[model samples]
Target: MLPGNVMEIMASPSSLFSAYASFSGSMMLVRTMVNDIIPRPVQAYLWQAIRRLFKANPPVQEHLTLVVEEYFHGQNEIFDAAEIYLRSKIDANTDRLKISKSSDEGVLVSFAKDETILDTFDGVELKWKFVTVTTRRQRRVSYDEGEESQEQYFELSFDKKHKDKIIGSYVPFVIEKSSELKGKEKVLKMFTFGGYGRSWSSVDLQHPSTFDTLAMEPEQKKAVMNDLDRFLGRREFYKRVGRAWKRGYLLHGPPGTGKSSLVAAMANYLKFNVYDLQLSNIRSDSQLRELLLETGNSSILVIEDIDCSIDLPERSAPTQKDPRSELTLSGLLNFIDGLWSSCGDERIIVFTTNHVEKLDPALLRPGRMDMHIHMSYCMYHSFKLLAANYLGIPDTDDENHCHRRVFTEIKGLLAKTQVTPAEVAEELMKSEDPHVALDGLVKLLKQKKRETPADGKLETVEEIEDQLKEKVKIE
Candidate 1:
């Protein structure tokens, strides 16, 4: 062993310890001096200043934030689309998520406020932050201030160089993707006027009706479906012809004839939201216009029992008050086909009435009520459908089935009398067994026939003869 080297190594430990002690003493002295000589606030300010000088600020070229607000006018489609689009980006690594479910819809998962979601598009890294800001407002009604309102937005951060790409390509991509995603898991919403402001409140639409289950005449059902298809595909045609991209339907029929059920079927087939606008709750024409504006695109606005919903006095009648503010037929007609109808696109307005003959000529015109669907009484065909739907009886043209004898008798009764599909459905629903249901329905038909007055008969002798002759011709 080298004596000199050993001594140096032993001395180095003491030197290093002394240096560390000196450094600790110096730090303690500086801290004590700061406490004694400087005010606490001043020391804090100095400390912040030092942090500001050294804290890393992202380069200008690397930072850009695009904000998407929850609403600007009415409800913003972009905000909604973004919300749906973001659902696909959620992953196990996500720190926080919000989960909600409607009574009839699948569980919906979304990113929570202040949660960050990272995504990559075209090799560009994108960061999304859900931000919520709350502000207090004064309750002017009580002359006091204690209410808090919240506004939410999404902050999309990416490199500054990709701004054009994000706007031109990525944003549109999001909208398109959202539409596809929405189509896959459509949860129809039914909105009604309620709550404090008379605004629309929505719940999951659990309607089980569809075209197949609707017991309308085959010809009429086909016509309605065809009309809807034409209307949906003619958006550009409407634009070229300078027409508002909307359609109006007037469903007129007696009670229990499935007017409301048809509306539900249409909504289900189109995958559109249903907005039941109660004109009775509406006070003024302006209010109706505002409510219409609040509705989303691809929605069916139904005003059931329109003939009795409101009193549409003749336009010639003089008004003591300002009629502009009142809910008048003129205002409704204007919103139906006039300039206000152009406010939205891909909309359908349905008006249901028990008396088609009672509606004003202006209200029943071609443009206002484009299609007039007469939901007539149940025919032999509709009875067969009800039998099939309720009793699991297969709808068959073959007359050799065991229930054929009962169906034949029911058909004869239907031909001679008027019975609503709803009534037949109720009778059919009484028994799960097809034979029992058919027999009970036959008894009801006989009772109804025996009670029918001579004047109340559905067909005259001449009409019956004509139908017989037409049937012979077909045969």
Candidate 2:
């Protein structure tokens, strides 16, 4: 009747539960009023009076007429069930409902679109209801000064879910909360609609950026290409390996060696976003873990110039630092290898350093640095690669006469000249005429030879590589 005057019927918890009582006393009382409480003579007289009133007011009679069905009948099943769940908040069949744990509780209900319930009494049951859900309750604070006549206690309590957990039109994963007091293990995943997040397993490997384009020499290029293919293939094959799904690479080489370019190539090849993590961006190791957790998958986490970015304490140094600058070496170590690393994969860790020797050994241990790639200087092969790349003329097995002659002269000079491929590429850009640059290059090599005397005054491919290797190594 007019939604049954909800304030009176539901304001009290006891009154609300009365409707669902299996052996309902109120039902019996209603029946008793119909059968015994009203005498036959008095009921007949009352019925006559009601009949006269209904004849006088047909509209009121029409409004009052309802299909008298079972206890739960002709009601909006979803809405009524939800309302009962809200106020009474109990599942009568549950053993826990028999034993009151606290003042408040919650319940979870599962239902099907079409069930046996429709066949019997409106297709719903007392069991299909919300019990007092046991969730972590957060206490909110309210403060007012000088006005003292309220229930002015120290704290106020409310359900955590009441405070808009489902943000920005996103629904939360419907998972059960733990009953225990300690922190619960949660499969918490954050997702934004149509945002750019990807899985690393889907990274494309056929792109030119997948390896250092500057690499040359049949054996060297083959190894570099194979190593890269094997790396990507192996990762794809074993997507979820070991406890941690992380893959680490250590790129070590002299400055100007294409280490950074290799990283850019990797990101471009994979189409993975490059998360260039500056050591300065992270204040401490714990913060580092948070950023790692927040970072999208299908991305590379780079710590460039690892040896020089942060003042990494030596392995034997104090493990813990004062609270002020609490990002100690141990905390970083724990994250890199401990339980935290197992959080997620779909990511790669790349550490580039010109001073690999200066890095702590612990940081470079086998599993710590999964792959070690050394980016070295221009060999005769790499020189030809630069020649072809910049000059747009084939240097090896060349049918082009001009390119072949320049390549031959340059190959001879490479024996005596210790210029970088970076330098060679630079010089090639100065003149559009490859032959003219080749002549100038030969003259420049002679000038360099006179001014910076050849280390041991002779020339051979192996000797040039060794001498240049020594110079590059020292540099």
Candidate 3:
């Protein structure tokens, strides 16, 4: 049925090869023309349509997935933010979740492993899945080290079109929202260094101290609060000025002048954790640096009784034949204001001492201790606060306050007598009735006034106690 020339071409090898070559050349030319004429979007659309035509069902969306791991080198910031941000999105539909609690914060809830959470941001729906994979490996370092561990991560998926929005806006929004939530439910922690290992352990700080309950001068309290507010609000300013975002305070006074109480109040006011570092326990500068580095940001490091903690050699001292420990005053100063100080941000350093005069001039400089607060003897204003706190006495200005008459007498004695707020608070705690407590405080003040020397100057309470102890030793 075929034509004579076509049948001859098909049967002959040379003729068939020539025909195949011509056909391939024509197909290549047609493909090149189509590629050059059609836009990539249109080509893709056509390709997808052609593929979908043969399939029973097709995927409805072009999805892009991002993996956020829990720890790479250290704890991952994005993973933490995601964990906090997604807690608000855990609806009743979520099958499982993790719940935790601290002493202060009632409860904290989060996602459990393999759980999925659906969230919408800026009208775009995103799917988040908490993934966990467990595996085993050889522990070459130590036999006690765990050979098996779980790796945790989050898989965030969304349509491919909103990649830029998810990265640029939504991710940042999540971080900001997490920060806000953290601020709202922050539970204060008290960290202390244990012997050896140079690590820190923490406990919930439940000290019932606040700015409202502290017995301090009104002006001093206001100044401290304002300074804290300014420091917190000046993160960008610190960056612009090329300085470490930190503040330092030196609290110097007698033992009973509420230095520790003041520190507690500051922690409660700013919602910052406290790291109480004892220098005597530290063996070397490296250990000190490690301890300080272990402390997190937005924390306070307190060196209490710094005068008695260690005998820091003067900078001018000559090198000895052999030093006992590598810890030096210069190293401490460096940690305070040197290059190491910039390792973290939003930090505060506090040094408390009974004798500021014993400290080196280098340690008392402006950058090292930005603010030096002298916790003086109790005054009438302080006593009023104590009265209000302990005996339920109303404000001094209240006309009907039953303690107003006693307050005037106590005010006169407090001006002449040198008594600490702690001493006064102790007196106020003796009796539940305001009148009886106020009367006892008056008697204590009169007794202290009578003991005052003729020159109207006397040794500090600590010095007098030391003298009495010496006398007892002599006896």
Candidate 4:
């Protein structure tokens, strides 16, 4: 029959409904039977083919993903900086936060794992996801030893079209910002070595010494301060000169002449950490190099009593050996002025000695020790400072008769004999009373004067060396 006639016959009310129900049931039965009879592989192939035939094409888009692993090349500096920058951007959008304690910066706040944040820079959209993956490893045992290790990474996605801008401009900007934040938030830490050939230990530095409180001659103090200021401010200048952005200082004086105190003052002035290197503890040149490499930039590397620390041989004496130390004089010189010294920037190396004349002349060369500071005995101006520091004598009160008389007497005694600033400070600290302290200091000065030689002159370097040798022998 013709299609129109057949449809009209079937359109009768009762027949049409029954015919439609029967057709639907028959199709469902056929579908179930076919599905049961077909092998899984054949079904899957058919389904995939159907999907490919009907599926529409996706929109045209390009994406680039950059992954920053937590530990790259065994150092976390770049990763940490990236985390700091990404966390700051993510913090505003993410509700979940992770808080942790840090030894250097105290409390730290970051984004929680699996949190995704959207950010935009330079008209390009970027997405950052804080992801942490836990991996379980099996160990050899009867019982299953599930060792779970966590790995953290930041996945950054941006449009491929803006890849160059993102890599060249945005990333560098983030690093610079991170450095600025670190400079503002992080506290300076002082590191020191303990025991023989052990790793460095650190603590929060809390020294309160400063140039103002330091008892020294006014001119000398000013010069030291100026040199420090210049060194700190000349990062670009050092680079222009093709130098290592480092400065060396040679502080020479007798014992108890405020060398250590001066180092503390320098640390405080620059807000830099002090790495008090004990060369005796270091066993070899390799260990020393490792320590220097590990030290952060903008730190002071101090070697106190360098003369006594090791047998630093003269340049001419290459065969001389120190049985107590394996590190040679050449190795030390290399540590100071060699290729490895360029590993860090904005560094200050200070070598203090009680007997500078006995030191190797190579160490005193111009390039090795840039500034040779002579921390001499207490002078008139230094005594005045010590008095003011201990007894609260105002520098402007020159008109006070008692103060003037005490100052004149102290100056005369200081001229007649040479006593260390430490001795004068110790005497001034004997009493809290201003007059008593000043009078006690004067008495100590007179005692020192009487003990001076018949010529009333300061001890020569030879005499001081002889006394040191005798003292060492007695000890």
Candidate 5:
């Protein structure tokens, strides 16, 4: 019935395929136009009607879900925190670990999809589900040229009865725990300056010192630990009192009396990084402030030998300007207590000196240093602690007569001699044999006593400084 050319064209495979594709495309265009022309309310009603006609209702769940999107108001902190918390739970519960590369840390672990976990807080039950959504979009020019994207999120569900508590208390608690976990997982960093105008260099801090290992009076150690705990716990109190959330410690002691060890111990206890600020290495007041600004929260800033670190001119003394010295006592004081100090929270500043009396009156003032710790000469109790640590002597029992005798002699010698902990520790390390170590310690104590003046007087700061300079010259 048709012409030969028309029959050939209709029978061609390419022409038939093209006609089918054109029909499909025209139908899609018509559907899109209809959707665009329809009012949103009418379209929604039609969609609901269509769904009701063909789709089954989902089963009701007793708990309501709260979805935390990855990006909210251009910040991902909440999403990140939730991911961390959930990942920890998943790691504990599941066998497989999902690993991803991170810019800050080399690698990070997270939960894989289809993993459901249950978490409890303050006797309330909550469930978290890891969901992965994959969406495909076709290009306008070609259907094959399209993009696929995957979005991940966490679905947290809890009973309606716990809605208020979960929002108010549990969320904040999770954030805090997440922060603490992150800190604990990271390596502790220790920073030190090379010289004036030089930047700080960092190393992995591997200090073995702890409150239990440091040789000090038990009561004093307890007091220091308590004070540190109070400081860590009193952020709200500090804010309420209109004070910077920082604490200053003044450690005054003779050389080799465990001041440095105490600083290390504090860092270990608090899990804080230490920035050993060599005051002499700092060139100017502005540099000092910059260094302080560079430091992060939950860190200890230490200035050792504070009395000798700088030539702080007295307020009444004549001003002799030193071109090299730009860091004045006033500037230093301002860095400690001024507006700059309020930049970070949970910070601690420590100053160590051999001579408390030689320190300026302003430095010794009450409000300047919150706590003044006097690291005294090795006492009997401290010696006992050292013995336990070095020789494995148990403080619990005095059953062994040899150990008892050694303890008694050491106690007597310690009362008479002002032996340093460093000296005692060194003597203890000389021999693995407990008896030999104790005997060597006693001999060293006797030798020190014999060398001392009749009044058993200790060298003053000025005398010590002179001896140090002489020693340096000899070296």
Candidate 6:
């Protein structure tokens, strides 16, 4: 049945291809391939082979293939060295350094089993030793797969000792990434120390698809990608730019704007873990410090809904504790770059809030929150993302009369409507099929537009900034 479908597609003229000519596309009977209809194990091998031929990045395979080959050679060399080391141990009679005890509570040693031979100190053979010693073999239990298995070896022991020898012990510790290990490589290790953070667990992030499930407009998507490239940074080049080994990013916009999902994608792109810091969990500065210290290096520490976590000290109600001061601001500052802020191994700290301007100025300073990313509403391009994500159309960058009309309405609606990607996604999910829902959004917008009055003018930023200065005076 699958072969027949492929045969039909191949046999059919790119005949039904006119609509796609304008870079327009269609929802298809086959989102994937005929072989994809087969069992996964067989498909896995075929997909593996396909990746060799056509990877997302062609250079990756070429370099990766060479790297694997090099690793194989290096492993062989290590095995050969091990073989030589084993032969040397069997062939050489390495001098044994042995210790023995004496009657005076001082230790005695011997070139021979008899202590008189090598016990001489300061050119005098001391016969003051009043104790005798005996040596015996120490055996440990061993497991054998079969009766024919080779014999077990024994360690030397004193005749009187009954139990096995205690092995030397040392404190168990986790080594933080060292500067030497990072070297000139652009990748720096992210380390958090002396902070209130999870010592054993850091938040995990899902990978980002190269493409958003929702289609984006070509120009808008390009702009977003370019902006993100500069802000989120490239894997290989960020450190050379004199930026901090760690960066603080602010993601702010209306609710349900896909900020959380974008974070997941960013982590997937960077292969970073997420350390989701909760302000409520941090009642004291020290607890915050500890939590920060415990997070894994190469992580994205996120404080979602940051604006609501604590009102700006000024806006906060009067209390015994000064709400005007972030009870933990000093601690947060230390984690940022204060003298106490040890540059952690390369990490990105993300703070998401609907209200960014309300944040404390010191907290938002250049070095503190290095990047401010506005995850704005679903623009025309962003609509494409939604369409693609829900509709699975690969978005041939199409702009038909219906598509154009609907997207234009969405853009206008977005200008006034505080709809979130999550909200739109919810709508898409409510219907059994997305293509039909995409059409429904157009009708919904028209009805909403008529019901709502035209967007009345609002105060401009300069006006609001001036008004805020007068209306909301700070002490």
Q: What is the TM-score of each predicted model, taking all chains together?
A: 0.73, 0.50, 0.64, 0.62, 0.59, 0.48
The list of candidate 1 runs beyond 4 A from truth reads 1-74, 93-170, 452-475
Candidate 4 global Cα RMSD = 10.1
Please, what are the lDDT tens digits per residue for candidate 1 over residues 425-472?
999999898888889999888887777655674763346435433322
Higher-scoring candidate on TM-score, 1 or 2: 1
Determine which window of 10 residues in candidate 6 has minimal summed lDDT. 62-71
lDDT of 4 by residue, 1-475 (tens): 5698688766778778888999999999988998899988998999899887888996457899999776543224556577767756754558888776644346667678788878788888988888988666665564685555566788889989899999999888878988887776655568886533224556667666689888776766777888888888989988998889888999888788899999989997888888999888777677787677767777899999998987655556656445334666777898788887788888999999998888888888876888877777777777777777888877754576567887888777776667888988888889999888888888887887678565656764345435433322100
Q: What lDDT, from 0 to 1, does candidate 4 have?
A: 0.77
- Quote the RMSD, in angstroms, for model 1: 8.1
Q: After superposition, how far is residue 205 of candidate 1 from its true place, in Å?
A: 2.9
Instruction: Give one digit per residue, the lDDT tens place, for model 5 in 432-467.
Output: 899899989989988986787656686543453353
**What's the candidate order when arranged by decreasing lDDT?**
1, 3, 5, 4, 2, 6
lDDT of each: 0.82, 0.51, 0.82, 0.77, 0.77, 0.49
Error of 1 at 468 (Å): 18
The list of candidate 4 runs beyond 4 A from truth reads 1-178, 182-186, 195-199, 313-325, 453-475
Name the best candidate (by TM-score).
Answer: 1
Q: What lDDT tens digits, residue by residue, belong to model 6 across residues 9-41?
A: 667667447436534333343425544587778
Which model is ahead, 2 or 3, in terms of lDDT?
3
Is 2 or 6 the stronger prediction by TM-score? 2
Residue 426 shift from truth in candidate 3, angstroms = 1.9
Colliding pairs, model 3: none
RMSD in Å for all candidates: 8.1, 20.4, 11.8, 10.1, 13.5, 35.8
